[model samples]
Target: MSVIFTRRSVRSYLPKPVEDDKIERILRAGFQAPSAHNKQPWEFLLVSDREDLKAIAGMSPWAGMVEKAPLAIACCADTERSKFDDSEGAWWVQDLSAATENILLQIEEEGLGGVWLGWYPDMERVKIFSARFALPSHIVPVSMIALGYPAHPHRPADRYDASRVHYGRWGVSWEESRSGA
Candidate 1:
């Protein structure tokens, strides 16, 4: 819970490199994520090369931070291992989402910071990643996470809202129950 509340999407990073052990722990957390039918249809590609990072940063407008990050992990989906056929119908996206979240939480635990850069639904970006990384046809790039020592301080946000909570029925507000109405 502490990790969940403290996790922040850190964009700016220091030049210091991340420890190999921390990276391993983050990947381990990602692998532990739940998947549909226990298919575990995910493959992680770790990028530490300066040239490769710069090239990948060019893949998306929102991923410019990848150039500065000490490490970048390409979160990919293995369609061959997944149960669904086409990329559109595959449950791999949900599985990968859970994995990504777990990775972020673990990053927070490691005292590092990172941001999730989306790519999967965008075919052009996916094609670029595949071509650049020489990913096999069975693997589809889903997201890229840029990680490093944070240049900024951690600030957690509390997003809970009672108004959004419903008791049982669709419109039965939690407020009504609390007020004994």
Candidate 2:
């Protein structure tokens, strides 16, 4: 719970490199995320090359922080491994999302800061990154995370709202439910 409350999106980073062990731990945590049918279809591309990071940052409008960060992890979805039917491979998105959340949480635990740069469902952004990384056809770029020591401090947002929670039934608000209890 402390980790969840302390996690925040960090865009500004100091000019410091992240230790390899910490990055590996974060990636390991990501793979621990649950997936549908236990089909873990996530592949991570760890980028430490300065030029590559800069180019990737330029690829996304919201990912300028990547250029300054010492490392970036491109979260990719492997279509071949993911289950698919008539509808598109929707399960992969959920699986990747869970993995991404785990990575972010692990970053906080490592005393490092990171920001998730969304790209999936945006065909143009996906295509750009895929081309830049020379990704194979089976792998689809879902999101990128810029990670490093934070240049500025950030506080976690209090997003909880009791009013938004319903108990027992759909229309029974928390207040009413508590009164009954």
Winning model by lDDT? 1
Candidate 2 lowest-lDDT run of ten: 83-92
Candidate 1 lDDT over residue span 114-163, tens digit each = 99999999999999999999999889988889999999998899999988
**Candidate 1: lDDT of 112?**
95
Residue 98 Cα positional deviation in candidate 2, in Å, after optimal superposition: 0.3
In model 2, the number of clashes is: 0
lDDT of 2 by residue, 113-136 (tens): 999999898999898888888999
Residue 60 in model 1: shift from native, Å? 0.8
Each prediction's whole-model lDDT (CA): 0.93, 0.90
Candidate 2 residues lying further than 4 Å off, grouped into runs, are 84-88
